[model samples]
Structures are given as C-alpha cells and as structure tokens.
Target: MILFKAALATGVLTVGLSASQAAYAAPLSASIQSAATDPRANVKIDSKIQVERTEESASGEITTTLLDPATIKVIPGDKLLFTNAYRNTGGSAVTGFVVNNPVHPAVALTEVLEDWALVSVDGGKSFGKLSDLSVSETASESAPTSRPAQASDVTHIRWVLASPIAPGASGELQFRGIVR
Candidate 1:
C-alpha cells in the first residue's frame, strides 16, 4: 500500500469547488488553497482530493488506499473522493452555509453520504435528493415525460449545513464519484 501511494504521487489534479450561490470559477490543486472569503458569510473554503483504492488480502479481508490525484494517472472506473472543506473565518457565526461541487463531465456521481446532500441533473440548475427529483423520459412516441432522477444523471452535488457555523468553526462536505 505504501509503495502504491508513492508511485501514484507524481501527477496533476484539479478539483472543482464552490460555496453558496457564489461560484468559484477556478479549480484547486493538491495543496490547500489560501483562505478564501465567502461573500455571503465570510467563511473560507478548501478542498481535499483523494482516490479510493480497495485491496483484498489472501485472508479475505479488504483494505483501501488513497491515491494523490495530482501525482498519478486517473483512468476510467477509478473512484475518486472530492471534499469541499469550509471554515468560518469571520468574527461571527454564519447560518445556512451551503457547499456545492459540480460533478465533472468525465465522472459519474456514486454516493453522497452526507445527510444534507442533494444532487442536480439539469447541469446544476436545480438540486434535490435522488428520491425526490425526477427526469423527463419518453413513455410514448408522441411526447416525453418525467421520471424519478437517478444518481447517474447527477450534474452537481450540494449540502445545506444543518446548523450555524460558529465563529472560527469548520466542517467538510463530500461526495463520491467513479471515473467514466
């Protein structure tokens, strides 16, 4: 595992990040970005990039590894974990902090384990739980209709922080995706 980690640590990576309705236009690198001020609440946003590695031993046990996306080659079927880390850098508490991540075109969103997480299929125009959302499908040759949205159609992922972020407090929102 250690050797694998080392071998995969020499490539470039780009993680998309955004907060609230304020769209962060640039992609992030391996190291943490300098503290960024959220226009709505004065919070700072950071991101973590880790690749999922599952290994099985002869005894039938499994272990996972982290691949530095920046250093190694990411191919199809590789599951990558994208994290949007936030901090309340302002002097006062912040309410309704929203962390959003736009799903990359080459990746298919798999899991959003956070309770507050939501996904959008219309290119980030709207977001809702997969169970509550729907997409248009054709039931007949005459017209197209709507249907329950699936994880595979997700274009963006979001999380609504349940509680206020106290002054100097921090948290992270994450989602999983598979390279396609």
Candidate 2:
C-alpha cells in the first residue's frame, strides 16, 4: 500500500489507500495553507522527512544516523522522522498558534510528546489520548460499541501553542512512525 503522510505547522493530514482517494486530494492543499495561516502573524513553516539508523563507533559508542529526505527510499519496517519548524517573522507576538501532522496509514505512531500534542484516530474529526479514543469494529454497531485505539489507528497529530510566539522566535515539533 502507498500511504502519504503530511504535516502542517498548524495540523497534520494523512491519506490512506482506499476507494475514496478522490475526496482526499482537494483538501490537502487547503489544509497545508490553513496550517500556516496567521493573517497578521508572519510565521514560516518548513518540514522534512528523515530515515533513522543506528551505528556503533570503534569505541563502542552508539550513534544515530538521520538520512536526508532526498536520499531515502522508505520501505516497510523503516522508521521515518517528520520535522516541522516554525519561525515568527512578524514584529509582534503570535498567539493561539497550532500545528498538526498526519500519520501515514500504512505506518503506526510509535512515540510522541504526550504533553505537547493530542492525537486523532478518526480522520482528524476528534482527538485525545489513544486510551481515551475508540473505533467501531462493526459497521452496523451503534451506541459506543467500539474498541480502544491503537498506534496504527492514529490519523492525525495536533499541537496548540500554550503561549504566544514572540517575534524572531522559532520552535519545532517532531513525530516518528514506522513504515508498514
């Protein structure tokens, strides 16, 4: 399956292999723009994907390798890191800023900063802790007949700035997932 994961400084959107692929194409561009929108707030957002690897030095020291996004060819079981940087270029403070990133459908979320963001398992409609979210296993089931969410169930990740981002200030948010 070919899965696409996209992250916006404001929010994350993801697309999975399904019959409704056409419905997902239009909102992608709009969502990216919306994530970076601040009106008077001038914040620049940039993102890149990296593949993770581990190496051991002659001294037995362990180090991590973050391959450049341009050079990596993702495959199943490979870990991918998505990074987003937001810089406030405006002359004033930007408040109520939020960032969202979508997890790839074929990949599952492994680690996340729980204190920094909320996760959604239902296509970005609602978000919360994985333990607090549930998904219906039966199409005909009604009235809370659902199962607890798992890492593979995640659809989007979102972070809301708790404080105003001052001019000339910059911040970043990152998330990791394994390719299915």
Candidate 3:
C-alpha cells in the first residue's frame, strides 16, 4: 500500500489506504517509490532524480549535463524535472496502478510527461484543465466570483496506468514544476 501526504493552502491532504486497510486489502501488493531532490536506495526500492543543465563551452558551444538533483538549490522561477520510478517487487502482477502527487503550495505545475494524467486545482476535489477550473474569489463580503485558474492554482496531479505491471517489471512517471 502507498500513502501520500501533502500540505495545501487550506490544510494537509492525505490519500491512499491506511495500515489497517492494507492488512485487509487485496492479495496482490505493489510498492510506489519517489525521490524529492535526491536519490535513495534500499532493499525494497531505489529512486533518484536526474537534473538537466545546459552550459556554454569556451568555444561558445552549448552542451547539456545531467546531474544529481541534490546538488542544486531551488529558487523562485526555477523549473524542476522529476521522474518517479516504480518497481514491482511482488510475486504477482499488479493492476490498476495509480500515482498521485500534490504540488507544493509554494510552487506550481507547469508540465507533465503523461498527457492522460488529470490535474486538480481545487485542492484535489476535481481534476481538469485550468481554463475548465475555477475558484471562489471572495475579495469582499458582498458576493463570491469565479475566475479562471492560473498555473499557480494547480494543486494536485494524478496518473493512472493503462496496463498492468508485471512481476519484476518497472515503470516511470515524469513531470515538471516551476517555483512560485
């Protein structure tokens, strides 16, 4: 079982099955792995972040470098690319696998690799595009107005796999975000 916890504007949002539910859940078990800004390894999982950088040579030639994300310090307006790798360590195949990542309140969602994934702007209540989403704008006490969502308004992202993950198989999910 996998659980996700994130801080939002209103409060914290928690998802996934609890320990008690996992005990009584289905027979097939799978693990979800992630890395924040660095790499981690253990008996059950191994995860890492691949940072992309462009540098100019003495000859004015442009080159790209992939480094460890831990070496970088993030600031406002900086963009980050993250890849979450999932390994199926279970004996049986796992189906209907899904991963949900919440965008930190200090940052915003910019791009995602999986086009089929859904985005939520209302603290994960509903998922859709920014133009299709709206929030209650209550600048005054008279009445509340709805306005189109900006990139900063995005709160959560979710991805659902269309195929089952076989035993010993691995997969990846990638996304990009910009600091506010």
**1-180 per-residue lDDT for model 2 (tens digits):** 111234432212232223233123212221323224543236666666666877899999999998753444445677767777778887778777766677766668887754657899889888787778888786564644678888788889887778888989998777788767
lDDT of 3: 0.57
Model 3 lDDT per residue over 3-115, tens place:
33222222111133234432321121224365332121111323333445678999999998765534444345555565667776665666666666677675567787887
| Cα-based TM-score, every candidate | 0.73, 0.72, 0.66
Model 2, backbone clash pairs (residues 3+ apart or across chains), number? 8
By TM-score, is 1 or 2 better? 1
Tens digits of lDDT, candidate 1, 1-180: 000000111123223322321122124332222334432346666666577889999999999998666545556778878777778777777766566666767678888879667778997788787899989888899998998888878888777777878888887777788877
As for candidate 1, its clashing pairs are: 9-71, 10-71, 11-70, 11-71
Regions more than 4 Å wrong, model 1: 1-41, 58-60, 138-141
Q: What is candidate 2's CA lDDT for residue 84?
A: 71
